[model samples]
Target chain A: MTDGIPAAPGTDAWFHDGPDGFVLLAGRCTACGALSFPPRPIPGCPNPDCDGLEQHPHALSTTGSLWSYTDARYVPPPPYPRPPDTEFSPYALAAVELDAERMIVLGQVAPGVAVSELTVGMPMRLVPGVLVSSAGVEERVWNWRPGA
Target chain B: MSRPDSVAVLGVGMHPWGALGKSFVEYGLVAARAALADAGIGWRDVQLVVGGETIRNGYPGFVAGSALSQALGWQGAPVASCYAACATGAQALSTARAHILAGLADVVLVVGADTTPKGFFAPVGGDRPDDPDWLRFRLLGATNPAYFGLYARRRMAIRGTTEADFAAVKVKNARAGSLNPYARFRAEVDAETVLNSPMVSDPLRLLQICATSDGAAAVVLASEEYARRKQRDAVRIRAISAITPEYPRTVPDFPYLASDSAAISPPASRTFRESLAWSAYESCGLGPEDMDLAEVYDLTTAMELDWYEEIGLCAAGEAEKLLHDGATALGGRVPVNASGGLSSFGEAIPAQAIAQLCELTWQLRGDAGTRQVAGARAGVAVNQGLFGHGAAMVVAHA
Candidate 1:
């Protein structure tokens, strides 16, 4: 954290460094027992048949397995906040499957992990990281690191 | 069981695909005129017009039906506009078919045109956190190729597919594209060329990906009676299936941060793309074995392989084996992308699905000079778009 505040507000609600460890906020449906990440905005369960409007905030398991991975070799177009072209370096993205949630989540991998170093089915854990540094404040984002 | 009533495709036309410095309206007019002339029907004869919307053209793009009708000298024909991302053209054709089958129109003109911007397609301006497309680009810098790369890597891991298999797709499609006059990239490519190309995403080379291009495609469809009066033999549209994924979609799709969890229930046996093809097969009472040719959305060489399995041409994880056996190449069993595919045409967005239909029509009619699938009878065109849009059409000789 910079300036004693999270760079991207509201993002902290999704993931933060708790006293125990990293926890991901998710939504659990009371009626159908459905679970969703990033929480549904409508306050209702996605299940069409179940009219479960009462959604309770729940913490998701931080550990998962690498379902897939890729390396972005080219620079993407705008609105993607990044350093200048000269400072740019390719980064690897990973899709991790949380066994408890039975869902796959996508995130940037930790800085040092290269594409060659990673393999499918490798265990990974969620960790807080910086997406970009601007105005002397590091934009908080989540990353997947190899090992639980 | 008696087959459902069908609509006849009286004529089909297209504007060559490439980076042309022209407006979409200009290209649309040329394709519309050619289609009308080919059908031997005047513009005034068409009772309805359906146009595929283009995102690049501002507000007018939303009302593409009226814009194209105006460009063709409108005769007060009823107009409908549709947008389903890359599946726009198929939706437009479906709309025209509905009008004809319902007795609302005797003849319908279906058109789709687009002038794509250079570089990777970015989200429309403004920051709307609710917009998934914007979030994907802003948070992860995930371009379209990034998603393609992920799928390719997953296939490699799960199916033991090799990079050489991916490169082989490019070589095969490029060779077919060399015979297609309408294709932008007419030069044949080899495995060396694909391997030597710079990497845009891991496991995918630059030449293996499609580029953005400008193009237009149109078709004239008529009621069974009207078509019989004009020409006894015409290409008949047996079915056009535009389907969305079922709830709890397990597979990862574009513009999404995560896949829907399957905690409450097990994932479906069929994937989203497989279901799309199955819907068309059920609608037409035909299976993959009935197909003589196919034109699929090959946004990347790897994607083409995925389509081969999804379309039921082979079993899961056997697409590479099918390719190696020369079953998907021109003159092979169930030849695919005989029009050279997006690998050769690049992507013109709205125009692509209709362009696929144009190739199918030519092949069925024995009019495709050089790239003809000999003795072709029935063909299928399959495509998927962002935000859960999937479309497929089955066509055969009347």
Candidate 2:
């Protein structure tokens, strides 16, 4: 286990080989062992019964259900990359329900995923996707796709 | 012991709302000066100033309190600019009210003004992975009209709310707005015109949506003791509530949400909008049955239908039926949007909430001509939008 990876990865296996067979990382409360994604920054566990401050990082399951979806019709302002001369296709946005994490993480769906076909309870899997860097450096963003 | 301070609305001013060329700051400044003059004070006399922020304008997104403060001749009064999305103006007013209630200042001015971009306020550009507003627009291609369509369609499916019913609301507001000379659209229209008008989205037409306009509204609020000392009109602002949505705002649940989840626990009380006004009522010690008149954020024709229920006039699906029966008309049980609302007046964002206050103040004082409620003594104003925000305020004559 590579300890102390600053700026925790959303999925555990994200950096191991860079999520082609991507897996997400979450942290579990060492005291209660309750798993959480986007890992808790505060050392104390969220569980009411636990008094522990130590939170150890753990890998979370990548497969989950598509919570909901919508197609964005607007461009987002900064901290996000924008491609000039690239006619951006309006893409599908979805929130996937990762149960073990007990939370919903929102992400852009993979290319050509029809919003009409997506259902509230449909299963989804997170995969490594292209970020198309601002300075011509291809960074990666997480995306969910139907039928893992 | 902190002695509570009550606020009095002195001067209320509104510019004729429409597609004007002037910047929002200019429009708001004119109204601010007019309100100050109405309060028998100059801009320099005000101890504090607050501005409701806007989206289309270049002002708020840049520097707002300074934006208007500079427009009003750099008085250098303590300033705050609030952005509560659709609830902006009320949020602005709420800030001043808080200051007054806390005895921080005796006299304050609240202003909301906007020169809106025509068509819908679309999301800003770029492939943003982190933003929900951009995500909804990009992924769903959901224009503001799409949500309007969804609500209208839902009303039609369940409430028996027809296109004609929605049209009637516009017709009523237009006829009323025509008499005011302050409304953007004055031409009286029939349901036929609404039916025949080109469809911009699924169920709503061009006429059904309030147009973007250039406008400003301002009200000078003074502490109760301060108002008596100044010998000005002593009107009291009862309550202002800015409430956010519950944990999981769902779609079949929320017009803006993409979809709903089957897992999370449902809201224990009322829907988000209903609870917002309900809390306001509890705070103010009044109920919907006691309201003399109301100015709801009628962003769309169908939205007005929902507001009817949210304000407790009727049940969720009964708004359309109530509309057809003439219960919410100009002369109905409770005359809604008595000042042409955002329905007759296209949304002016920051200014819109204050504009609602202006109408309520007039109606309560029995000054609203033609559109006035017969004996309007108590009024409420409600507005909500984008960032899971909702606002409501109660106003009554002393």
Candidate 3:
């Protein structure tokens, strides 16, 4: 995997691969009609009355609106990243609105994006980002950010 | 749930909560033995054992039941381990309670123990987007403190709580913890000390949150007949409720979220924590107002305020007023965290819930020396499992 790909981004297989080779996925309740982006996995619907079960794969919107953003400081432990230096550049973590599922998804802003530049209600897209190593293996991951 | 076969706590034990410089199994074994001794029984009397899990131990949480039993000397009991994040202790005790309550075993030993990581607990290593806990730490760098921070902020927004109001909790719990020999930070703190501490998260200083500790706690639950046969003032676990989150857990809870409802609806205004206590009350025919003493999961100083409302100590937005008015303190109308709570003991995960009972059992029995609630006859312990879950146990003596 190249560190920076202009159009192609993403490292997982839930979402259908596109021209840029971005793969996406979401969570759908087979027991009921609920659709979620990252996917909801509880014993059931979490919706008290719904009591739905079996969280199956659902498709997520490739684009959405920014719900909120915060400049998070601190280098997350392993299974995450270990910045070569201890200097953990605060990244703007955001929850994006995917109106399709009526749910919110969270992701990191693309590597070069600064925290100050982002705002609530900003339009954003699901872009491919570097996948850090996981479970002793390297992989690509997806991130959401404000559109250019 | 039945009179024919009822469950009784026959054994109780624990190691002081702190950097005990020991392994999980060792601590667990010690606590187990204490329970056996307290119940006037032997490990061999236990027909089954259930252990709470700890992630750091790698393999134990899922397989520690037999490990603990073996540590206590190969008693040949059926062993089971459970993992429910913080609620593991209650689950373990609940398992034992079921065994006796179901007439499967006349005597059972339930144990939960953990040696926690020093720093803010993080998800298992690796960049697995599929894992929400890991993703939150990786993508947002939001450690447990961040979530605590969010809750503190929201409490302020929704309830008009202030930093001083939150600090008052630390002062109260610390003073109580100071009297408990098993506590980690025994020094009584003041609101000023809390305000001056380094800020881990906005509106929450370092002293405002619980630390990680190494500890173990065990309880021996027996059938009612077993208790009657022994026929002493044996503490009886009147109720155990392990309830899940409800839809729209809508209690203004985004503060704990590193992200939003990527999955389920927030539970309605009736939170799982609230419902958890409700279930216990239903089972015992009691309510918060009737509680003589309480042991709440003070995961964070601010979270204690949230639990106040959840357990029905007071109505929503009234916890701050209660804290300031000294109604929840040792001398308050209904004393809470009389054993100093998670704030004083730090969190030992699996051991915490059972430990809460250990304190209450001692208090209600009038054995608690300095930290005893004056005439505490009925007590409750409330805890939460991971991914939005809750556990509550009500204990009363006859």
Best by DockQ: 1
TM-score of each: 0.96, 0.76, 0.83
B1-398 per-residue lDDT for model 3 (tens digits): 33542367766788888886678999998888888898898778888888888888877655878779778888577888887778888888888888877778888888888888887787766545556666555545666666566557657755778888888899999999999988889998988989999866555678888999999898888888877787644577888998776654433232233233424453255657788888998987878877998899998888999988989988888888888888888878888898999999999998999899899889878888987788777888999765765799998776
lDDT of 1: 0.87
lDDT of 1 at B287: 89
True contacts kept of 2: 0.02
Error of 3 at A105 (Å): 4.8
Model 1 DockQ (Cα-based):
0.69
Cα-lDDT of candidate 3: 0.74
Model 2: per-residue Cα lDDT over B210-252, one tens digit each:
7778888999998888787777644678888888776434443
Q: Write the per-residue lDDT of candidate 1 for residues B1-398, one digit (tens) a residue.
A: 11356888898899999999788988888889889988889999999999999998887788888889999886999999999999999999999999989989989999999888988999988866667788788777888898888899999999999889999999999988999888999999989989999998887889989999999999999888888889734689999999888778786688888888898877777888888888998988888999999999999999999999999899998999999999889989888998999999999998999999999999999999887888998999999999999899999876
Positional deviation of residue A11's Cα in model 1 after best superposition, in angstroms? 3.9
Worst 10 residues of 1 chain A by lDDT: A1-10
Q: Write the per-residue lDDT of candidate 3 for residues A1-148, one digit (tens) a residue.
A: 3344322112233345455555457656676555544455344553445667777775566788775554445454554555442455555555566765556565667887865576556798987665443332334556777883
| Tens digits of lDDT, candidate 1, A46-67 | 7766798987778888999999
Q: For model 3 chain A, give the 10-residue run with minimal summed lDDT.
A: A5-14
Misplaced by over 4 Å in model 1 are A1-12, A84-86, A133-137, B1-3
Model 1 - which docking category? medium
Instruction: Locate the minimum summed-lDDT window of 10 residues in model 2 chain B.
Output: B253-262
Of 1 and 2, the candidate ranking higher by DockQ: 1
